[model samples]
Target: MLTMNDLKIDTVIVLDGEPFVVQTTQHVQMGRGGAILRTKLKNLISGNVLEKTFKSGDKIELAELSRTKANFLYKEGVNFHFMDNQSFEQFILSQDQIGEISNYVKDESDVEILNFKERPLAVNLPPKVDLKVTSAPPGVRGNTARGNVTKPAVLETGHTVQVPLFVEVGDLVRINTETGEYVERA
Candidate 1:
């Protein structure tokens, strides 16, 4: 249990049976009353933002969050599937939960999954991932009139990213997962 005074940014807590990550916290003292804490929280699974205020001494359950290594299995319609490496347990997450990680993850790749109370909530990807270029358009020479020198290339995961004109099909590249940008050839 955690009291209002313990609330801080990045703290994970359970309210009304839902897990939330604290985005911001402020201790405000009303001129004539005890201090109150105003907090901005983000739903870890649903990606919702909520504003909540906790009066002094209010207590909340600290969420039980865990991360496990899982290998990407496949995607069906709106759901993505993974298998735990250790336990070999299978799990599914909707597209909403997969979110941006879909851009960098590929079939059979190992990723980290965040579980809330032992249930899968979200997928956490590394800062960089190596992917083989599936297709890249031939670079046109002397076409710098518009000053755009990069061309779109498709990766093994089917994610499209811009690569320098020199990059071509079959090249393995390291990409920044967060920004979906090309980092360098791996």
Candidate 2:
């Protein structure tokens, strides 16, 4: 059990028998009445979001979650496939559940799968990943007039990211998965 004060971003709580991860939280204070907590929660099972509010002194139930190593196999249609490292069991997560993380993942990469009640709910990627630039337009001169000079480059994973003008095709670049931005050459 946890109090309203314990609610914060990334906190997992059980509500209506479903596990939800807190995406955002805010504290509100009334002039003379009690305080309250406002939160946006994402459902771990269905990938749905809900906004909820709780008053001060409210008790909440925390959800138990686990993580396991898995290998990303490939994507078939709208589903992303993975194989458990230990058990060799294969599973798939839809694009909806994967959200934007799909843009950062590479084939045959290792990742952590979040599990609840033995069910895989989501994928966790490393903060940074090295991917080869499969395609990039030639950098032209005189583009430096702008404060920042960058061009869109297509990665091996089929994701496009802005890179410095010096970047070219066949170059291995490090990307920040969280921000989907180019970090540096690998």
Candidate 3:
């Protein structure tokens, strides 16, 4: 159990019989009225986002989310497989549950799986991942002065990300998993 005052960003809570994670929260106090907590929450299972306000001290249900480190194995049809590094147990998650992290994860990559009441809800990749560029066009000479120019490059994981024009095949690059953006050359 939790109260509106205890709401924190990224904290999972149960509302209306569904699990939601707080994306952002602000507690506001007015001189003429009572305090309220404004929150932006995302549905853990459906991936829907909603903004709602609650009176301060209002009771809320805390969701039981468990996170475990797992090593990604492979994909079978519509499900992705992962092995628990500690228990040697395996689990398969649906593509929708993986959300954005699916784009940055590669085979044998370490990931964090978020489970709600023992059911997998989401997958979290490392903050940054190093991957090799498997395909990209050559950059024209004298393009260095271009401002933040990028070219689409396919990674070893079969995911495509925009990399600097200077990037080429076989080059190793670091990518921000959360934003699915190129960070820098590895």
Question: For this target, which candidate reaches the highest lDDT against the unseen true structure?
Answer: 2
Residue clash pairs of candidate 1? none
TM-score of each: 0.82, 0.95, 0.81
Using alpha carbons, what is the TM-score of model 2? Answer: 0.95
User: What is the C-alpha lDDT profile of model 1 across 49-80, one tens digit per residue?
Assistant: 99999998788899988999999999888789
Worst ten-residue run, lDDT, model 1?
140-149
lDDT string, candidate 3, 1-186, tens digits: 788778899888999988998999988897998999999999888878999899966899999878989899998876899998889999888887786777778899888988888777888777899999999988876666766577899999889999988899999999998788999999
Among all candidates shown, the one with the greatest TM-score: 2
- The parts of candidate 2 lying over 4 Å away from their true place are none
Best-to-worst order by lDDT is 2, 1, 3
Alpha carbon lDDT at 69, candidate 3: 90
Q: After superposing candidate 3, which stretches have Cα over 4 Å from the reference?
A: 16-18, 26-32, 48-51
Candidate 3 accuracy as TM-score: 0.81
Task: Tell me the deviation in Å of residue 185 in model 1.
Answer: 0.9
User: Number of clashing residue pairs in every model?
Assistant: 0, 0, 0
RMSD of each: 2.7, 1.2, 2.7
C-alpha displacement of 44 in model 2, angstroms?
1.5
